[model samples]
Target: MSKIAFIFPGQGAQYVGMGKEIAMEHKSAQDIFEKANESLGFDIKKMCFEGPEEELVKTEYTQPAILTTSIAILSVIQQNGIEADITAGLSLGEYSALVYAGALKFEDAVKLVNKRGKYMQEAVPLGKGNMAAIIGLDRKEVDSIIKEAQDVGTVEGANYNCPGQIVISGEINAVEKACELAKEKGAKKAVLLPVSAPFHCSLLKPAGERLSEKMESLNIGSLQRKVISNVTGDYIANEKDIKDLLIKQVSKSVLWQDSIELMLDGGYDTFIEIGPGKTLTAFTKKTARKLKKKVKCYNVENTKTLNKLLTELG
Candidate 1:
């Protein structure tokens, strides 16, 4: 029998009015938003529903908003009897996965992620660090390009998103140089990402350090379900490992492609992306095609989409 895995997307997936439909239509969803506001001590729902786009995009607000929205949607799905056998998320999404797995409480995850976002945003000065996407380049070639640009600064592969799409992050100069080198190495295209910080790179070490200290003060628990780590592409089974990996994940490359493969290898053929955007679903389809695997992927952003997914899965 095929098992279902619920995945969540990270920072770049958020948009204005992402969770408004659910909050407006479902009491459970509305309760979630209200709880998030209470737990966070602010009106996160307003920022998510009526964002100026710029304010919503701020890292601090973005992380909690996405987490709350995903958990709210998950609440709705669970009410309807749709459950996940395993859970995983990418980067910021990992917090959502932990909350779903019961390793972290929703309220604590919200506060922690808010701090995480703030620390990450403050890690590097504006314009000092950057990120870029190199499309149509194999991992080896992308790695080579990043290595070649290391002399300019500390360029490194950050997000292994799909078979031929990788994101690199580092010093702004190094990232720009890497993009040029990627084009020369026959990448289909290399473009700078519109992000504020060089996430998932060595430049984020300070942020990781801060997060580690903050995490030490929190009460983390054992997971109710399996959760794959983005740092190692492995299932984290212990609380110690979870804390360690979460800290390291800030400056470590996100092995998203490997995590997906690991899940596929473990008998999860259906992946349900429970978040605002279909970004992960799109990437999963590409990866599945490249690996010649017959996996079904779905993205449920609202009740209508959730209903469709349940019907299709049935």
Candidate 2:
């Protein structure tokens, strides 16, 4: 049997009405959403289902909303008897993976992410920091470009998403300079990302430090499933290390491609992205193809995708 891995998406994947259908059709999913409202002391469902896009897009609101929706879908998946051998997620999505791995409680994860989002947003003022996706460039090339661009200001590679695709984040001028330098260096496309803050870059170290202090106060549980750390792109074995890894993840580059490669090399061939968007699924497929590995990819977001996953995975 092919081994299974459950992956979750990060910030940009969220949207209004993401979990509405699942919550309406699945009792387990609904209960998860209800629990989020109780723990959050706010109508997160309303923000997700009937969003004023502006409100929903705020980093503070977006993190919790995405985490709740992902976990809600995860509840339905668990109710169906589906399970994963290993799990991982993109930046904010890592919290969902940790919850799924039993390293943290749902309530605790939701609260932590809400605080994380707020801290990250406040780390750097808006318009002062930015991120850009450098397409059609290998890691070394992008790294070199970033190194050169650093002379202009503080910019560094943030997300090594997949083959030929990496994101850089830092000061706006530095990011723009990197994009221009990348284009001149034969990169196919260098597009500025639509994000509120320069996440996964050194600029967010202050946010990470605050998060570390908050994490030290929590009673994190032992993991039931292996979760790949974005900071290291490796299995996070020691429960004691989870807090530090999470803190470092806020500012370090997300080794998404490396994480997926590690799993695939370990003989896992199935990936199910449990979240709102197909972002992680798309990246998984691309990474697998680049690695010349045969893999199965699926995502569960709504009734349609859930039914398809059930039909196929079963």
Q: Best TM-score goes to which candidate?
A: 2
* Model 2 lDDT tens row, 120-208: 99999889999999999999999999999899899988999999999999999999999999999999999999998999999999999
Model 2 segments beyond 4 Å from truth?
none
Per-residue lDDT, model 1, residue 237, is: 69
Candidate 2, number of clashes: 0
lDDT per model vs. reference = 0.91, 0.93
* Alpha-carbon runs more than 4 Å astray in model 1: none
Q: Where does candidate 1 clash, by residue pair? A: none
Candidate 1 has what TM-score?
0.98
**What is residue 66's positional error in candidate 2, in angstroms?**
0.6
How well is each residue in 108-153 modelled by candidate 1, as lDDT tens digits?
9999999999999999999899999999999988988888899989
Each candidate's TM vs. the true structure? 0.98, 0.99
10 residues in a row with least lDDT, candidate 2 = 212-221
